[model samples]
Target: MDRGAWLFWVLIASLCGASAFFAAGAEGQRRDVRAASVTLESGAVVSLAEVVDGDTLLVATEAGEKVPVRLLGVKAFDTKLEKDVTKTYGQAAVDKLRVELEGKPIRVLLHSTPKDKHGRTIATLFVEEHDVGLDLVKSGLALVYTVYPFPTMQIYLTAQELARADRRGLWSNPAAVLRADALSAEWRRQAP
Candidate 1:
């Protein structure tokens, strides 16, 4: 080929390469923007690294990010941070959660609000193909927190009420700590 013809082909090839690079960069930016938006529909498989009480957890996603997840519409017994004291039913609630979800793959459904004040991702988690938040309420391990309105909030609240009436788990105690007062009294001093 003549020099002019070869030079023309090289210019076209360079333009094509530049276009491809810009296209790829734009796609990446779009994905990042979507992730920042409210209510993403994508699914993520995460391993449960730690249960922060019954309703929150530290999960390691397949993408290698460590995320804190707050269970939607439920409140569990508070785990004691200090060695000097323990909360009633706190350890039991954690034990139940660990048995049900620890080391297992969880599916998270993010809410429009996204993160809480503590920086934990506010989401509804599913485990073993069932709604984890509902299960905790049905089993009487947690109470319906109703601070936010969600699609499944009513269902969870109903189940929790039944568990309370049946006097299961935390409900069985004579002290009967409600979600608001669960952290107030010591375990041993509270009636059983």
Candidate 2:
């Protein structure tokens, strides 16, 4: 179950048959917990373990909990697919991300809409303020995900352009194998 759903049920169970005054107190506790989370997120450093893809990772927080954080601003190729080319690029992306992110101390910056539908945090990861998503786009390992708004959209878009111009990583594939025009059209379709 998602954390929110679990928490909701927990609150309901606690508040059941309680007085209105007790319910108000429970509400205050929830707010206090939220405030604590904000404080924890601002400067919390996490130890990385697994790189799920170019744009997601599994991190071990100080509380000994594993959190799946989806890196904001970029979407990477999925290695799980059957296509050879997609798997090739996906593996490269995962390898690069694992090398750079795994076993490292990194900070997570939660964006305005922090969590996705599945409860994974939507956050920007930093290694000394350098965004991991931007780095991947710069290396052509990921594409800018503009299906929604993000603070660093332009920065990611510029990196993708530079990578394309230099024919780096994913852009290194021949036009016969990877069609730029088709990709561009597809990306446009994803834009809001």
Which candidate leads in TM-score? 2
- What are the per-model C-alpha RMSD values against the true structure? 14.2, 11.1
Number of backbone collisions per candidate, in order? 0, 0
For all predicted structures, in order, the TM-scores are 0.67, 0.72
Give me the overall lDDT of model 1.
0.72
Model 2, 92-181: lDDT tens digits are: 878988888767789888888877774567888888677888988888778888777788898888888889899888888874127444
Q: Write the per-residue lDDT of candidate 1 for residues 92-192, one digit (tens) a residue.
A: 67787788887788888887777887667888888878888888778777777765677887787688779888877777765544433453233224423
lDDT (CA) per prediction: 0.72, 0.76
Q: Model 2 has how many clashing residue pairs?
A: 0
Weakest 10 consecutive residues, lDDT, candidate 1? 183-192
> Candidate 1 versus the native: TM-score?
0.67
